[model samples]
Target: MQNNRIRLLMLFITLLLPGIAMAASNAKENYGYYCVQCHGMKGNGMGLNIKDMSVQPRDHTDAKAMGARSDDEIFKVIKEGGQSISKSVLMPPWGDTFSDEEIHDLVKYLRSLCNCKLGG
Candidate 1:
């Protein structure tokens, strides 16, 4: 019985692990498709368009900077565009393109970039 239980637990974990991994992977893909041009693959704000833009993109990897903002603020900016938060209009609205769940996932991914957590 003990051996069977151990095997069952292992099987359960193996099944659960892929979903967690796939969520992260999907978030990365979303970031690459929509944000990499301005945020860069490394989230360093050194994207291809850096030279042309009047305002520098926020560095997602900047822990101190990213940590200052709340998750709701991040979500608002992503969904409604930076202008919604009185930021640069260069950050276009993605509300039309992505669902709220997807935007939340992106926010989570951005937080991961800086190793930061949203405060309550």
Candidate 2:
């Protein structure tokens, strides 16, 4: 009985470990569904169609660049579009397309990818 309990605990840890470290939800999928052409899967600003455009997409992993912006700034950019924030106009306003809550989730999801916070 004691051995069985220990084995079950080990199994539980094995199963639960992956879930605890699971990456944030759907950011990859969202990139595929919407941002792949310009932002790229890695957010390196080197997406497939980026070369033909006048302005390059923001590099999500560029800690130095993204660090200066605040959550509100990022939020506004995502909701109202980048042009409103003086970024490339290619970033279309998602304000009409998704709810405020959805936009918040997107912001969190993006932050996760960059391993960056708005101020960090």
Candidate 3:
């Protein structure tokens, strides 16, 4: 019975791992296509548009800062724009552009970039 359970768990992981990897890849691509203009190619908040912007973009690579923000906050900011959280209005909303799943993927990608988790 235990062996069967183990096999099932292994199979589940095997099936799920690829989807996780694919989500991450798609998130990266989405970021490149949509976010790179302001977030920068390196996720360092040094994008091409910074010179014309009044407020600087958030640095996704800042683990300490990123860790302070919960995943939900990130999702809301991405979907509703930074103004939704009383942050910089310069960050525009992508609610019409990206699906909720894509926004979740983006939150995951940002976490990966910072290598940190909230309240950790």
lDDT of each: 0.92, 0.76, 0.95
Write one digit per residue (lDDT tens) for candidate 1, span 1-120. 999999999999999999888878888999999898998889999999989999999999998889999999999999999999999999999999989988888999999999988542
Q: Pick the candidate with the highest lDDT.
A: 3
- Candidate 3 segments exceeding 4 Å error: 1-14
Question: What is the RMSD of candidate 3?
Answer: 2.2
Task: Name the lDDT value of residue 24 in candidate 3.
Answer: 96
Clashes of each: 0, 0, 0
How far residue 89's Cα lies from its native spot in candidate 1, in Å, is: 0.4
- State how far residue 43 of model 1 sits from its true place (Å): 0.5
Q: How would you encode candidate 2's per-residue C-alpha lDDT over 1-120 as one tens digit per residue? A: 999999999999999887544433544555567776888877778899887999888887777677777778778998899888998888988788766766666667677667787567
Model 2, residue 11: distance off in Å is 21
Q: Which ten-residue region of model 2 has the weakest summed lDDT?
A: 19-28
Alpha-carbon lDDT of model 1: 0.92
